[model samples]
Target: MKKILSITLMMLAFAAGTSAQQLEKLFEKYMEDERFNYVYQKKPGMVERLNDAGSPDLWVFEKSNASLGRRMLTLNGGEKSLEESFTREVETALKADKYEQVSIVRNGKNRVETYEKITDQGIAKVNFIKNPGNIMVTLNLYAQKK
Candidate 1:
């Protein structure tokens, strides 16, 4: 009986690990680009910075809710609001009939929020986790360009 119990426990652990791995794989397929240099999460804000090699003055920062699933894209030195950029991107993409299958959801129990951008660029996804203290956050960035 003890041996059987031990075997069951081992199987359960393996299954959990496999699930986590699958989640990570899915997330990877949804990130923006590989050129992003800095990704940091602070209180109430999560920032992802990317540099445009062709135009040094053009810097993009994706800022989103550290807790909720709301997100916005901003030009670092530009006068435009991040929210406006976010809206414009969505509108343009929709008008061009680019992204039609994208979806987003928040899992309260796991404290994880996922965003899946399904387009010709492939699926770009992000996962955010809130730690026990509710003060620290872990963000998994995944984007497939082309």
Candidate 2:
């Protein structure tokens, strides 16, 4: 009975690992998508010193309601092209991941787009915005394991 239980536990672990791996690959694909790369060329974690060398524009933070917490490292600003192409890329990535377009608001030159995906782990949300001068992107993963 003990041996059987051990095997079951191992299988469960493997299944969880596979799910995580698939999630990661999807993220990488989203990043590598030509539409995304064409607009924001900088890779994640490449700090930039811009206009008078202000604080690093890129930042990420994560918090959980438990003894375990996660860290979110995000990229803030980068090269920007036509707003039309960038928005298309955003929609493509989100839709491919099965995230429903939650909302999109436009206030003149500024616009915000939100997408949410329901997964076994929890809700995965992504926010994308474009202003007259720069674009902002953030990813939020809730109830995720590891």
| Winner by lDDT | 2
lDDT of each: 0.36, 0.52
* lDDT of model 1 at position 116: 46
Candidate 2, residues 1-146: lDDT per residue as tens digits? Answer: 99999999999888766654443354465565443432232322223212212433212222231112111222334345445555565556555566777889999988887776776767665677777656555565556435
lDDT of 2: 0.52
Displacement of residue 144 (Cα, Å) in model 2 is 7.6
The C-alpha stretches of model 1 lying farther than 4 A from their native spots are 27-139, 142-146
Task: Please give, for residues 34-101, the per-residue lDDT of candidate 1 as tens digits.
Answer: 32122333323323243212334322223221122223222233333533443344344333432233
Per-candidate clashes come to 9, 0
RMSD of 1: 18.1
* Residue 86, model 1, lDDT: 34
